[model samples]
Target chain A: MEPQLNLVRLKTMYEKMVLIRKFEERIIELVQEQGRIPGMQILANGQEAVAVGIIESLNAEDVIVSNHRSHGHLLAKGADPKYLMAEIMGKSGGVNKGKSGTLHLAVPEVNALMTSTVVGAGPPLAAGAAFAQQYRDEPNITVVFFGDGAAAEGSVHEAMNLAALWKLPLLFVCENNCWAGAQSYSQHCSIGNIAQRGIAYDMPGEYVDGNDVEKVYDLAVSMTDYCRKGKGPALIEAKTYRMRGHGENDHQHYVDKEELVFWTKKCPIGNLKEKMLKEGLITEDELQVVETVSKAIVDEAVAFADESPFPYAEEALDDVWVK
Target chain B: MAQLSFGQAVNNALDLAMSMDESIFLAGEGIGVSIHYDPNMPSHGLLEKYGPKRVKDTPVSEAAIAGLAVGASCMGLRPVVEIMFLPFITLATDMLVNHAGKLRYLSGGKSTFPLTVRVKAGVNFAAGCQHSHNLEAWLAHSPGLKVVFPSTPEDAKGLLLSAIFDPNPVIVIEEMGLYWGKGEVPEGDYRVPIGKARIAMPGKDCTLVCYGGATVTALEAAAILSKENIFLEIIDLRSLVPLDRDCLLNSVKKTGRLVVLHDATKFGGFGAEIAAIVAEDAFKFLKAPIKRVAAPDIPVPFSPTQEKFYKPSARMVVDAVKSITG
Candidate 1:
């Protein structure tokens, strides 16, 4: 039997996954409507399990730095979907006052840190956050989420080298989502898995089926614990895929139809629900109740976002300096 | 008060600041190690004093070094990082410009990022074009960043302390030529406010404005002009980003003449900003056309003979002042 979390916490995780799916689906509608979210939207529709699993093993203090595709991770870290919705819509009530559209949302209150828009810019920032934790002799670690395309960036290599050399408490989580803005991993990388690149830094790392939350969580527990124990940085390649285009703007004319169908069958939420039911972990009514709760939460989030006001035009000149 | 070299004053400021705030730490390439180590530079003896954790020595990664500062600053630590030289700041500009300089603004004034980038400017040691070019103009041009270049050992200590504690990203340019130059610096906790300028020498005929090691050039020119009974008031702009326009305007209003000088190339140099400020704000006070003394628009040469020609000399400043004050 798979070692499972308590039923309540496991069901909460299921609820969060559904909530993220609904939140993303709502955002797609907002983007389609056009004037609500002015900028480009990058949604993580099929990668909910990876974020939920990693966040399950993390503490409140673990600093998280993410990339452009960060809505799922933000939600997993307990970000209020309402402020996040307001933020993406350029409203004043956002966590960041709408200064960071969807691309750079930083909910510092939850230790979510900043979300960098640049492709490979997050690793170095994570290294620095990790360095600070280690310097303070604190047990808390830093987790940076990057994609496979970032693996090819020299900044990522430099960050890895520094983290290993200094024995910083850092976890390099590479969410290998198959494609980086429409360019497949095969085209961007010379190797099959990015986690193997850790060998050059003399750091231990491996890959896992990111679609399987239990498997990813089992590894995340060990990897984050390894970093928290002051054993230096660790790398993990969460092999996953986004069911949608890189951004809502693109059409997936380049994707293979058969491959998409095969992956869609491995849907994380559906698979987890099937397992839970097979083992009698949850009843169909309980699962349906969770979905209903998630939909209500997303409904409130959208209402809050719609009611929020846009920031003043002159507010742009503020916040550059302190005193 | 204590007499200290410009280099020692920097070391003193860092030492004092670290003693006061445990959050302040140092990280750079060969920080206290032999490669970038010299007993006189700002980071010397820091490793032995703070130990390995606080004074981190890292691999040759400029981007990571700056990114480290940006990350650490957000984590309630005031990280004082080194970019080695002005030219190498290019390697680190992405972190400074994209993250460090913008994160706070992006944070909607809700967060504070306190970090300092210590860089050497105003050519010395014949380190060639890559190592010797003064790139203060590049840093000063980037918004949300404060830039400072100390002309005196006193200002060196005060400005560095202020830069470290300032609740924003600041670039402290330690003029390489003035490292060993001696002046009186306060013992501890002295802070020269950012966005402030100091009048290096008081006079009446002309306002000679300059920064970094060029302050010495301006001073030398002042002495020469004084001998000929043509007094030139000197304005050493300690900070650049906040560009002390009031200081320049008031001095020019009194002197009725202006001469901007620096060791950087004339085109698009920070001196151009000073010239523009005077022309825009203090133009009515001018009795003659404003003059500028700066290096010619060319790469700083590798050869010492060529390097001397590349820098603006004391004679250049004197001539520049005479053109406006004659």
Candidate 2:
């Protein structure tokens, strides 16, 4: 009595998750070996389902303002991994001509407002975008991505308050990854869940198991629809964990080993693969093909990045103003 | 031409811009709420005209308001936001400086932020330390931002129009004290170009350069100096970011003396930048050492007597000019 699933779309989602995992794994290798990426790389190893689920629900015209840990979101939003890799490697061929590097990846062509390195900065930007969309009576919605750490920021509260007050079409997606760097959620947040904060803004808040990509996708679709209907903003707390350290530079001594083992067992990609196989939505061979395609994409991206050239020293002075 | 106060001129400009460009809307504290606040604050009565969607009366969240403006601008809407007091802009510097100012550059010129942030500068009727601040120096120092501090009612109307049309983010600094000052304003379709300075008066002895709240002080000092036959040229630098160095240097070159004036603190103020520009670029043209008439390096005191001493008045400008030209 399982619900019918589109095998083609399920395969696509699986491939994207694979691509994200492989892309992050390659970036870690690059950072370790050649020091290619600028700044610390915050890999979305286990949080791929949250980004893939939410972004899949959005139209190409809808805007997404991402936070520091945004690689998975960028990839899910149709950013070519080649340019992203080149940008991470600080090459001229990158999306921002390597001016932004890892923390500030941007692709305006797909309504991807540049990623903000500052904690809790994206929500206000999202609020602004949503306000514009609503003012113009455009049916587009804006989704702002933040972490458990950003839930405590006053900017987030102010932005949510404005979104509610104005009845803007905005979706606040909080990826509760259990830790803000070495600090655990128990220490950083008083509330057990970030979704509960949405009540303060008078918006519908929901929680989903981030490891279950299907549940996340269903919830994201509902929330995005709710906001787009002019019912004001909505909040979603996807309970998840950063399987890796906060950033590549973090030693991660604060997290208990038992907690890590528990989350690792609830791996999103693995869970999805098991579900699909159980339902006969995808065979092991089909899943292997998806994995192979993802690996090829990441490999091609790395090759393109390695072949890409660095920008000229004088190029730094460019792009500051528009005539 | 019709006579209008500085605040009326600003209201006229907003009304004109909104009439022409439906994309231009107002968002700020006290923008919607009418009655207690007077016409001197341009945002009064706007809510009735434009309704809630166009005239967004926001909560007292400076950061969110600024961020909303910048975000809307990026989406191709011209948002004119108000930061009630200049000092309160500190709460929103992250959005104004980091996001709004750098979005164009960081996005590799793919995005444009056409945001007009209207802030009132200088002391406002003993509004106290928190409210009374003319922090043009802080805004001018930021790259990717255009800072305009208009003194006259005419300039207020024209410059605000220009700031709205500007593709980048602009901080329009209005002087609270100049709100009621009346002057002839062009009836319609006016724009005072940014990055330009106006020569208020021509003279041969020394040049008095100032802008914002201090422009009135320079004009007042010009009148006194005229009576004394000092013949001090007065330069009102309407735009601070571009600095109007050519206009400033040319005036100094003609008069052979320079006296920069501002309401900001003397140390590390905008006057220092103007002074350095003259010292470096127009040093050969100077007849005497460059002097700056500015507020002392201290917070605006609450007591009127202490504030009077803290603020740089027309007397200070006159004294600085006498010391330099004597």
Candidate 3:
């Protein structure tokens, strides 16, 4: 039997994941070419499926709040790539008019409400967003994308408890990528499965192989449906790996060479392509088109950002007050 | 017209603002129950009127409460959250300073985040520095926040209403000592314009500027000085950031002498800012060096005796004015 949104979303998820991977790699190219993008560059290069698959399962009105490495989630949630790319380049056409840069990009039109660099901060904010939707009797849900590093923060636990207690329409999506700024998950936390912490908060806790896009999407669909039905919040721990170091400057000497090899072999994009070919979902020729289209779109985004002008220095004082 | 205490005035303000605006909601730790019915003293009886949905009681999660307020405000709801004490604000500062104050600016003015934070402040409680430290200057120093401190019941009611409606994050610093102090208050829909100072007791000899609990001391000092034939003009600086600069400069220009007072520690206190402004703008008009009467550089002690010493008193204000006037 076909799972809910399984086969139909698979092709789209593959395309979206390719675009996300391409977008993240483009930042690396810019780093080497332009001596970095004028700000702290954190790439979600390997965590592509977790972002693409879960976002693909969400509805248009659903809200998503994310953290520093948020480009993947923003792109997958239908943010305009040109504007987002411009934001990364510190251009006036950026989503926040270049004020937020890559870290705190907020695209309200896509229901991507907030992106904060503060670790573990997004969940509490998302809980509040969920509170608003619930208070308004709205059917939409708010999803917070945070990493395993954020899970160790007390605020995350507080958000979970608060959301569960108030029965808020929130879904906490944890991308457990095993490294929190050079510190391994084992060093930071004793709890192997963050999803199980949902039990302490009295919510459903589920875990899935993050590199498997289909599994992540199916689980996200179920949880979003649960929250939309006013069933309160749930937690999903997508076990994955960070293929590179934490930031643009990190050389990953602190990381294990063998661990990198293992995650690279399990690369979400590669696994998805293999699965699609094995299932006869797309022929080799169709796959090539998807890759070409994704690359061209990313190239266009870079061009748009390159052509976008930087904001004037005086503009910094403009938006401090709403009046 | 009705007589209400400073605490009752806040309740009146919340009741009126919430009724007039459906989008307005209250959230904090035990805001419904009044946090042991103590510092929550302002939001008493609101939970019954608005119910759990609007008048929310939260866990002892300052970050969550602050973040919730920021998050809800972003989504078009007006949340007036109570962060119980001043020092605890450090826990919520990330959400308040980084997100709440910064979000509207980051949005390039495309959105308005209209939320109010009711902060309990002062040193008179003798509850130690943890619960009683004053942080108005810190809030004011942040670029995107509006800070107001009311020393009387009428100003409390009016300022809270105005703060609740303002399009920026307005921090209403309530002096815990003045909560039970009573005064005449307008009944409904009254508003005191923020960033404006009031002349508590006017005179021509010297200008004494103060706010929150210190306003009481300044008024008392003016009375004592007046009896001694030294007429002290007392200006209650209601707000810190937008700071009634013209009223202050004009007052300093009139009296030709200035003294600033607050309960916060002397070094780097908001009083220093006031002193600097007068020193810069109205320097030619000054007849004496600007003086500041403030708490010594120390924490608010828990002992009532040391706490009394830790507080800025009328005697301190009078002594400061005397030194500058002499």
Candidate 4:
């Protein structure tokens, strides 16, 4: 059965995802040409649904903490593409004023906390935000996005235990793209499923088809609602696959060609487009308009980044601490 | 005036701050419980009397505890985080160093993290190396963080209340040895401002600088030295980061000698920083090269004999004073 989602909101979510895909592709091209981008880690291929689905379900007041692969997360959370692009370019006009680079973009207006380059650092920070929200008696929830590989980190385990025990309003979204850098999930994780870790903490856990955008959005919305209602923390492990290398320079030597092909067949964007067309939720012309608009927005953001000035030399000491 | 323990002084300061300013609250692991201290005990009972919302208990995640305190402080909450032990601060260093310390300067002065992290230093009984290390020197190196180590109950109450109200991240290092040590605390609320060192005792032979539990040791050593007609000037360095350079320099100039004491390891301790500051600023007045009497570069041992050797005592301070004043 189809879940009831508002058509306008669904289209907005689709647009956001497409824009993130285009923006990341542009970033990858620039990185390949220049051999450097301020924030090097890019989650271009594997984890769009995890960011788009969860962020789309959040209110502007709710906060988010993103991991190293945070471009899609930041973009989906409604950061200005121009500033984000400028940030990746290390320009003064960027969010974080270029001090954070790509790895640590933070926009306070949207309530997005600073991202961490460490794999499992965001969970504890998110738990802290949850504590703050609970303390203030605000109906805000903290959503943290991590990778399947980060599930092995002691910090993540500690964060989960704390979130559950304190009944903190937090959501742990694991984007299980089946690899951490070059190492496959089987080599790194003893347990086959990352979602099972949630049971140990006594928090509700679920696995979703990450490529199915509608399913991811539905689950995220429900989970966010549950967390807001003070039911405590929950875990949603989105089973996805990386279509690109671990980063811009990676050749993915350990990944099999067949496995790569298998994931490409399950492309999240492609599946969403097909679903929209079959269900008559949107016409081809309307979808074409979204693609065109997203491309233009991405193109404008890239131009803005290229044209933007590098941060002033004195800015290096700025934004390291709040005055 | 009323007699109060170091822990009681801290609790009184927190209660005074919380009552004075509605924004101030306590958050930490086991803060609300009587397990570590006592629920009816000064600080723990304040939470119960105030409410769970004001005196909150957090899960055993120091990073989250510290990070949340930093975030909340940025948003106008004066959060006093009770880190059970000084060694456990390593878990919260990222937030303390990167976020709390740098947040004010990073935002180009747009934000201030008014957070007070209360932790106990010194080896009380046999808690072993991991739990007994005095690591204030590691934190004092960070320019943005304010380090406070109070010796007496009055100083603990005043300095902690001041730290709670200060507009920066302050590390209040309490000594487990002084937790039960009683002193005359002021009847009403008061605050000992950061960046000021107190002259615990006055003399002309040598200037003895110390903080936390070692301040007691230094004063005791000064008394011993007085019996020998060695006039020792004891300076309690209440604040370490914004160190009272003027007081140290003036005292060193008058006495013509200096001896620094701490419970931390000798190398790279806060004593080193103080010694360097004196050498750089007041080297001309030195009778002898400044001496730093501190723990050897070893962990606090569990054995009573070894632990006594690991921590600096009055004898060591007296010997150092004698060497510096020779």
What is the Cα-based lDDT of residue B13 in candidate 4? Answer: 86
Evaluated on chain B only, what is the TM-score of candidate 3?
0.97
Tell me the spans in candidate 4 whose CA falls farther than 4 Å from its real position. Answer: A1-5, A278-280, A319-323, B36-42, B71-76, B102-112, B142-144, B187-189
Cα lDDT computed for each candidate against the true fold: 0.89, 0.89, 0.89, 0.82
The better candidate by TM-score, 1 or 2, is 2
- Of models 3 and 4, which has the larger DockQ? 3
lDDT measured at residue B67 in model 4 versus the true structure, 0 to 100: 72
Model 2: docking quality category = medium
Q: State the DockQ of every prediction.
A: 0.75, 0.77, 0.71, 0.32
User: In model 2, what is the error at residue A64, expressed in angstroms?
Assistant: 0.9
Residue range B1-326, candidate 2, lDDT tens digits: 99999999999999989889999999988888954577877776778888877988899999999999988888999999999889999999999989988878877778899999999877636767789877788888888999999999999999999999999899999998899889999999799999999998889999888888888888889899888889988899999977788898898888889999988888999989989999999899998999988888888888888888888888888898999888
For candidate 1, what TM-score does chain B get against the true chain B?
0.97
Q: Which stretches of candidate 2 lie over 4 Å from their true place?
A: A1-5, B35-37
- Output the worst ten-in-a-row residue range by lDDT, candidate 4 chain A: A314-323
The window of 10 residues in a row where model 2 chain B has the poorest summed lDDT is: B34-43
Query: Of the pair 3 and 4, which is ahead by lDDT?
Result: 3
CA lDDT of A76 in candidate 4? 88
Model 3, which residues run further than 4 Å from truth?
Answer: A1-6, B35-40
